[model samples]
Target: MDPVSGELKLFLDREKIRDCLARLARGEDRRDAALIRASCWPDSTSDYGVFAGNFDEYLAWVVPGSPAIPVTQHVLGQSYFEFDGALDGDRACVETQVISYHRVDFSVEHRDTTIGGRYLDRFERRDGEWRIAARTMLYDWFQDSGVSVDWSQGVMGMPFSAPHFSGRAVGDHSESFFAKGKAR
Candidate 1:
């Protein structure tokens, strides 16, 4: 392939890999198993520090809210990619920085935990599709804010009193929005 075409292909591959990362993050936050599954190969492996296992085990531990942390948001940052061989190689090593916020509701207090981390991933292109073949989560820093927001009082102490005012671990407001065909 010519240099220009090869560059374009590499760019497209990068985009695909980025999309997979986004899918994985969103799926984990929403606890959407199908979307999470689409981000990885069937035989993928994951080492999440607290949980390390095959794809199936990882799926079960991550989806449907394991560890009982009800709410989470994963903010993705810069990603660096390294192709296995030439630009046309089917495998790539990717490292993406992430900032994650988790709401941990304890028996007596609600705490917000913010974690700075990176996802080290091995991406493999199979059948013209890019997906994660292996992944490891590396934690850099963390902070626990004393208390989380009390959603019952609504935002800033102004009561809205509307259902779905706050996001849920399951059946979040986004689910209905997506069900209405708002998301692709």
Candidate 2:
């Protein structure tokens, strides 16, 4: 009956869903197993194009393989939530735009790989806590052509240590994780 109350409920629902997704992203970046386990439901399943599987198997595959890299920013936009008056849990759908770039020294345009995608999520509240029931990642476009790494200099135009893992190496890690599950 009250618009303010409705808005507050939506805001609270959205915030909880956002926080859960953020925690998942952080866990992936840091390769934190505990964080992933805590954020996702025990039976949660993620559909990311070719890679879709249960929680534990996915985590085991992802946690150890991810390499250390530059910072990643996950920008979330256009989130929608629906809660049936009779239902106890909240259902939320969000669109996320993730921009990931790597730079050893200079943060230039050429060194950036822009990837645009949307995250469709369904969250359910259980025991006063929210958990993701199902999630999907939809990629709209991805541009990989970027600046060349100057390996001869061993630095990206600045005095710094060389990258332990190259772009190819990082890619291999991802492929191994996602591909392994698909193979089986």
lDDT of every model, 2 decimals? 0.91, 0.63
Q: CA shift at 75, candidate 1, in angstroms?
A: 0.6
Per-residue lDDT over 94-156 for candidate 1, one digit per residue giving the tens place of the 0 to 100 score: 999999999997878878999999999999999999999999999999999889888888898
> Following a full C-alpha superposition, what root-mean-square deviation does model 1 have from the true structure?
1.7
- lDDT of candidate 2 at residue 50, scale 0 to 100: 64
| Model 2 lDDT per residue over 142-172, tens place | 7654664655466656654544333332333
Deviation from native of the Cα of residue 135 in model 1, angstroms: 0.5
TM-score of structure candidate 1 = 0.94
If scored against the real structure, what TM-score would every candidate get?
0.94, 0.65
What range of 10 consecutive residues in model 2 has the weakest lDDT sum? 163-172
Clashes of each: 0, 0
Model 1 residue 128 distance off true place after TM-score fit, in angstroms: 0.7
Report clash pairs, candidate 2. Answer: none
